[model samples]
Target: MDAPPTEAEVRDRLPAGAAPFAGRRTELAALATAAARTVPGRGRLVVLAGRPGSGRTSLAVQYARSVAADHPDGLLFARMSAPDGSPVPPGRAARRLLEQLDAVPAGLLPADPAAEDPACAALRTALAGRKLLVLLDEVREGAQLLPLLTEEPGCLVLATTAGPLTGIDAIDPVILGGLDQGAAVDLLGELIGGTRISCDPVGAADLAEACTSRPAALRLVAGRLRADARASVTDAAAELAPAVPAAAPQAPKSRGATKPRGRGPAADRRQARELLPAEPVPVADTDPLVAAFGLVYRSLPAPAARMLRMLTLAPTQTADLRTASALVGCPAPEAGTVLEKLAALELLEREPAAADGTERYRVPGRLYPRLVELRSEQDRPAEVELARARLLERLVRLVDSARLLLDRTAGGNPDPLPGPLRLRTPAQAAGWLAEERDQLLDAVRDAIGQGDLDGSAGRLVTALLRALPLTGAAAPADLYQLHELVLRVAERQQAPRRAAAALLNLGDLQAAEGHWPQAEEQYRAALDRARAAGDEPACARALEGTAGCHRALGDPVRAADWYGRALALRQSLGEPRAEARLLVRTAEAHTAQRRFDEAGREYRAAVAVLRRLGEEEAAAALSQALERLRRLVDGEGIVQVSE
Candidate 1:
């Protein structure tokens, strides 16, 4: 392992935002004091609890960068909430942090490593004795932070949450609120231009006040300002201010009211009227952020506004150009321009470019609910369903293309996939899979939720089973779940062939984990379904799976019987590659039973098929195994010549 990053390097590696981090000076001071008061051999945790758009994230990031020198081990950051505002499980967070540290090798982890105790153990081991600064952002609950917490005294954990975190001991809670007027103004100046604020100080102050001094709301206002330079601060302030109804004329107060200037009876009657507003403004329209968003949203070009609304239906909160294009049913370039506009207006956050140079954008947490509302009120149900269908189609095509590039099967060279989604090489395919794993899984759930429209969901699930390897992106547990989900969908759709394929997939995963009995059970079930459906290919695969399971359990006779059935099916199918593979497997079963003559015959038959198929590498490997077997038989002086 390399040495921990130096303080200077940590400073250099801090996350940089488009604008300078503003405000939260008092909050930063409290954090500094908490860090200074840390006891020896005991870590300190500070939870920055606040509502969304309160600048908790900015405060946490700012504090982390400021104290980078104190903790030289390194700085680690993980978001505990997923893009769709759901809590990320602690184990998933740990695995992610472990990946960041590069402390646990990927190959050493099992599929569904999150459920593995070893992952948390590896994380604890990696974090032990290190003076690291760990930032857990958007933590949903106190329990979610426990597994990720380290006992190392030298480290500090700074977490941000939307509400109070319970079930924690001796946690220092720092409440984050809106920024002060000065800081808000400065931030707004930085976003639009300092000259605009400098020209009209009072108007800028009113605008900041109108935003309630919230950073997120201020940024939205700034977006409006940037969009139209000719628009003045007074104009934005007036637009954001809720309209109040003119007060009704009041009758003169009775002279008798002088009896209760301080009495309870008159005061109670007066308070009732005060509680009701003269004008009942729509709560959504009264909200400054909502109003600001409305202003910006209304200003959008028709295509851009429609695209923004449709985005709320995306499988994930984050989207790339390809995803945006699919959602909007537009070409890529047009979608790119719309995305750039949204990012500019602070409606969407522009993430760093992907390895393939594809631009990505994420919806801000505060804005997502509002976007969903807009989508609901404006878009018809049929339009939303159509958009979802388009997205599902695009995802299926991309996954199929990726599967071809990985080429995990015996199928010969892959045919080229058309369009921008094509993955040209295995490395490229793997990278795309890893990067889009979350989106792909979410898309699967989305499709299943949509009732597997036209069986595309089933096709996608099967493709993923073949495309994603067990190593990095797709966990075994996840694959198993996908198989189960697809099986349910197929059974409900009365598609026996699809259900049999899913059963086979499930068996394969179980067999990989050494669960021979469970695997055989699944294979048997699949065999029954395949036979009922008259699906010969599925039946052959199910038989082959059962044979492998029996072979693994040391039952060579049973394994050989099952393999023979599969071999007959493969031969009848006239697929030379499939026949060769089945022959090799049968040879292994015969060898396990010490049937040397039978094994030799099977091996020779496999070599001839492979050679005829122009699979020289496979043929040579089998030939080498046959020669080794011959040498063993010669030593025993029991060699039998078999054709």
Candidate 2:
């Protein structure tokens, strides 16, 4: 096989250099201090630690440019990580550095370790007395850079990573966070123009927060804003709002929290999330950020690359082993290994175990869209759909099992004996539903949009609806949006019954929030669809919904009329329990209109049905209501009926 591509080949693939580095004053100062302290025969090493897109590479390039004149031997830059996210062999890095410094000719670096070792030694000897600056981008371990360092006091080594490089005695370390607010705003102004900022100072501030002041993110947003003359800072900020969470203040680094070798993958993920926020970074093919990430991503092993792509299917920013396994169709242990490797490469950040002890991992928000774009380009469309289908199927099963457990427990069944459940208990099931609520909602929305609703999408939608009441995780607006999505999907599929159900559900959500007119509109649509489909149950539900809206709007006559229709439907369908419920509602409408005798007759009818159905408690409640109403009608008790 041809000799592995050299580091220069990889370096050639990266973007030209970080674009006019805008911030990182403190980091630059620290580098300046370290450069000043270098002595002859003792070169200095500085490692920059930060998440991808935090501008570590840009800072390195800028620092090198600023100090180039001090080292007349010239500046050398090499990427320590292969495009596939693996560490480039130190010898490969050394050979590339040698070639850059003109100490070795191209294609002369030996492939054999025994020969390469002496070649690297000779190269090091030649560089011992020279002054140079070496910038290593995406360095993983300290060893990768150690071979390329020279003893010459004038030579300086700079490196960057998502975390610290342990086992390397770094002379100085600069931990780069997002740009300071002022620097971030200034950077945006530089890109998009001062007029945009001047027009909407508050929106500009919001944009900064939305980007978490990360330079790479700011650059992308500014690039987009600059391109679209009509796009206001506020509009861009709003577009980015969903991806930006409130920035969690960076925790002070504990002196003792050095990188540990062989830490379990679970521990690694936890540390990763703590160091990097989950805020999304925008990635366009032409974006410098994407170009930079693409360099490392292209270097990842095929398995690791696939894992990274499947990760984009994650419902939330973070995913656990089970989720990963489902997405990739692998065993959990194997999935964990893949995750650990990806985390090592800094493609995925490992987060702390949740309370239930499930290890979690997240693709850096900025990297997620980039990976997704790559996956779309690299993987066939059918393959992507297959992966998504597998994940949705798994989620559907999980939610179905959890709902079963919840229903069984609520029906007076004894507490489930301690055993493994898809979800451990009803309480745990509810919590899981709440946590995955957004993801589930997103899956449904995407499925509908992509026209994949007839398969796992429909099942997922049904499962989510079944679980939502138990979790109480979604708001009324969220519910309405979800049902609206389902309604669209149903209409597309020409499923009239499903369409009617979606409208009814949407109506219920609106009515619950006291939007009576909107609810009535939705209910009427449902009634029309139900009538077309000959779905009597759906018709009864729609009639009941409209009747409830009318009652809430204070139109007692209309409410009573609609309730009468629903009650008649339920009775004709031989649905005694539903009919009983409708009778109670109808009586309430009559009572609101001061028709106590009519209300009493309806109430007695409801009690008879409930008693026949063995609902003693409900029958007793209605019996008491009827007695009170009769007394009021006979004038034994004065009661004012409000309509």
Candidate 3:
């Protein structure tokens, strides 16, 4: 809270034999200059992009040290670990920064960033006036981290990342590159006592070339050289390779920053493998992010390989023990063990306890892109299907639970009732529905692809219709663009039952909005299809659609006739809820015609049906209708009888 243990502590704590922060003096200077821009009225964003171990951390750390004096208020270090081998996700990073700033308590972050943003915004408010140096490191998801940086003029934000954060270009970019040959050689000499290396020019150049000039690699090679009194520059250069796969797999680490046991000899023959690089890694050769990741991941053991792929199929970017276990066909404990190994190897990262007191793990940013590529190639249709099934099942249960807040009851069958479902009030429910709009649609689209039109098309039409009137939301561009997707599936699959049901709902929607002519077309078409399929229930709904449109257009006579037909059909089909609603509508039509006696009789029947179903809301409305008719027919009749 009181200015994160000063830069002095960090400097003193640097690992023994770590390079003397050399070769990147200019770049570090540039970062310092950027950090200085935070002058109480203007804020600065400095993004340092480079591959892992390209010394971005060293430069950023050194810059933090240099700027420490400028920001006496506080200097906060939140390792949103792209290099700490753990990918600190935006929410976790934000929470970490909040914790470091003493803004939010450690356990208050929400399970998801969507919910965590408000907490982060609160943190920003708390930090807004402070002169702080905040470093956001290893940003895999830039969008998530941007909100955490205080925009206050007093705070300096220096973010270290794998590449440009596409959405956040507001910051100046400093891409850290490996040192040039001379700088590399000079720095290696400094580490191993420059005098010894420079004493033999050719040997020093060879050593620098072999070191790939990357500070980490340089320090490593120098550590090995200094330890071996008999080792020559040529021998050390030969020991450090032109291409030591940036991957640091867990070999029993040797003492004092030793190079891998076999890496030096591998580099001595680098000229033979001209394609190999001598530097820390050019951030080239791996054309895409996946390629770079592939170079790192492809070397893992087969079980680890499968585990990595399974994690990619996780529902969210983060995975809990259960999710990992299911995906890997292992138990939770076994999954956690495997996850532990992945984290230890720096292939995965764990999030801090979220607001829910639950945590999840994920692949680091440095490894995710390659995992994505490997996953695409390795993900069989079967595996994807399995994940898809689990997700869809979960979604359906959630949606069903949501509907319970509407007071919808279970049917009369003896099936167990769903668990008590809680949701926000109607207004909040609508908002939530809006937020989940895309994910819900995505699920339906996938279901349609799987040839399940009844569920996909039906739920989609129901959701869109229900949400639209409440939300008045401008339909998403993609929603309208792909609205016809499920319709097409219904059409192609020859499921007239589903097709007619879809048409009836669409037509009913059109009719409700005063589009009578279009409504008539869809309803008539739907009616014909329903009749063709012997779907009496669907046919009745289609007729009801027609009657509602006609009634809205000032044709009570036609509405009455259509309502009668639907009522008879529903009675024949023995469907009580439909019969009750139609009966109530018919009674209103009779009242429209001033046939008070017939309207009273019909309304009484509706009240009986609603009462039996325990629909208090509907039964009350029916009782009101019957009393209105009684008032018209017999003025002396009591509208409310005294007991």
Instruction: Give the number of the best model, judged by lDDT.
Output: 1
TM-score of 3: 0.45
lDDT of each: 0.75, 0.69, 0.59
| Cα shift from native, residue 36, model 3 (Å) | 13
Best-first order by lDDT: 1, 2, 3
How do the residues 177-237 of candidate 3 rate in per-residue lDDT, one tens digit apiece?
A: 6776667766776777867875766666655554455565555445545645676776545
For model 1, where is the 10-residue window of minimal lDDT?
266-275
Cα deviation of 407 in candidate 3 (Å)? Answer: 14
In the order shown, the candidates' Cα RMSDs to the true structure are 8.7, 26.0, 13.0
Quote the positional error of residue 326 for candidate 1 in Å: 1.7
lDDT of 1 by residue, 1-643 (tens): 9776665786232334436677677788988887665544446777888877767777787888778877887788777886567888776677767666767544323334334544565677788887788899899998888777777778788899999788877777888777777777788889989999888666676566566667777888798789898998766765554421113111122233222133222112211111112223364334556656766777778789889888876666778777888888988778888899898898987766766778888787778887887778778988888888888778777777777767766465554544555667777777777778767777887678768364677667777877787325666656777888888897888889988998998888888877788889989999998998999999999999999999999999999999999999989999788899888888888888889999999999999999998989989999999998888788888856464
> Which runs in model 1 stand beyond 4 Å of their true positions?
1-18, 33-44, 69-74, 103-122, 129-132, 152-156, 243-286, 400-430, 452-454, 462-467, 470-485, 515-643
lDDT of 2: 0.69
TM-score of each: 0.73, 0.52, 0.45
